[model samples]
Target: MGTSTRQLNIGFIGFGSFAQFLAKTMTKQGHLIRATSRSDYSAHLGDNFIRDMDEFMGLEHDVILICTSIVSVSEVVKSIPFHCLKKPTLFADVLSVKEHPRQLLLQEVPEDSDLVCTHPMFGPESGKDGWKGLNFMYERVRVRDEDICSSFLNIFEYEGCKMIEMTCEEHDRLAAQSQFVTHTIGRILSEMQLTNTQINTKGFEKLIQVKESAAKDSFDLYSGLFIHNRFAKQQMKNLESALERVKGLLEAKM
Candidate 1:
């Protein structure tokens, strides 16, 4: 990793909406951003978009950021021609689940390359205004080049993100407790198909926001959160048990 925040050739493997959002910030910070993905995003990326994977790898990016969904990450990484990588680069991910991507990248990427498993906890909606104080969690799994890693991290630091350095396992455990549970309840409320009523309390209004926010994301994303993170299955079970206990208390009152 580079010690200073110099302009880097950052290439994105999946140029989705989330990737585009991050690219906007990095570009503003003077990093050259280029991308290749399943779809043609040339119109959105302008000259920065490279349509061919072979060509994308040949660009010799200082950092290769993987922005694929949890479910598709394995497939996407497997399909990549790593041999085409022009040089040893830092490979980072912005997946919601940490350990899964961490394991995948370690197994797939070249031995010489570095790996950083990251999860930018906020998204396009929460970060629409700016990334100030937003949680940016990362684990420097295999960092041979500290200067380059620090430089890439400086991009988020420049945006006022609360940089959190923790192990991928710890991240998954905490995420299952907080993020997974929140999404589970949001999905439940969405299933109820909540609608605005004549009389709405502040708490109820917040629930509506949760439902709307969760609904805005694809079912694939929600499922990926639940499916990819091993800890999430236990969290789902806990949620069910807690709901049952609440129902029992209510039944006793009745």
Candidate 2:
């Protein structure tokens, strides 16, 4: 609600859960958003959804944020014809890593536009607490455009969230560590079921409790951090090596 209704026409390319949440939050700040979806979505902005690229022509959108998955993001960018993006649009995405999204920013977006690459690090369960935990970036963007990033920062900080910023290269390298490790742990924890309700200690129980609560989030989303992220493959390798060492230690004890 910090921004006035000057109505910045924001366009979102995907209409999934994360995309829906982001659009709802942005709309609350008085942004005039137009969204596109391949599937039926329930947003108030659903009228903006364009199924065919041919229908999206002549759209005077200011900022276009793509919230699609790593698998579909490439095709979305490839479909944007160069001549159609002449309005200096600002582009961003909430994809887990910068590999594909960054490639689109460089190769697909109109050359003259100010490009912003974002990664919303939180999920649907976050609710009002979401943006606080969201790690994002504004690539090659004019530092003076504080309205967009700062507004979001204020919203998050008010909710006890730390907003972190870094270049796409740094973000990807670090996410390989932060996200990959966390998801691997969450995945392992989620797959196990503890039948002894009273026998489980407080620490062990709470860790599983956290995982159970987080289980409400889409594992498919977490899978992106572990799978599509090119830089994270090495982190997985290192983890496997550490596990091998641990196995040897346990065998020695046996």
True-structure RMSD, every candidate: 2.0, 3.5
> Residue by residue across 21-130, what tens digits does model 1's lDDT show?
99998988889999998899989888888888998898879999999988899999999999898789999999999989898888999999999988898988899999
lDDT by residue for model 2 over 1-254, one digit each (tens)?
12233456777787887777877766766777677777765445555777665555458876677888776777877876557654566676778877657876677666666566666667676565545444444344433355644543444354444556677778888888986777776667777754346678888876776677656657666766766677888988998899999999999998
Q: Compute the lDDT of residue 91 as modeled in candidate 2.
A: 70
TM-score of each: 0.96, 0.81
TM-score of 2: 0.81
Worst 10 residues of 1 by lDDT: 1-10
> Among these predicted structures, which one has the highest TM-score?
1
Each prediction's number of clashing residue pairs: 6, 0
Clash pairs, model 1 backbone = 1-145, 1-147, 1-148, 1-149, 2-147, 2-148
For model 1 the local lDDT of residue 110 reads 97
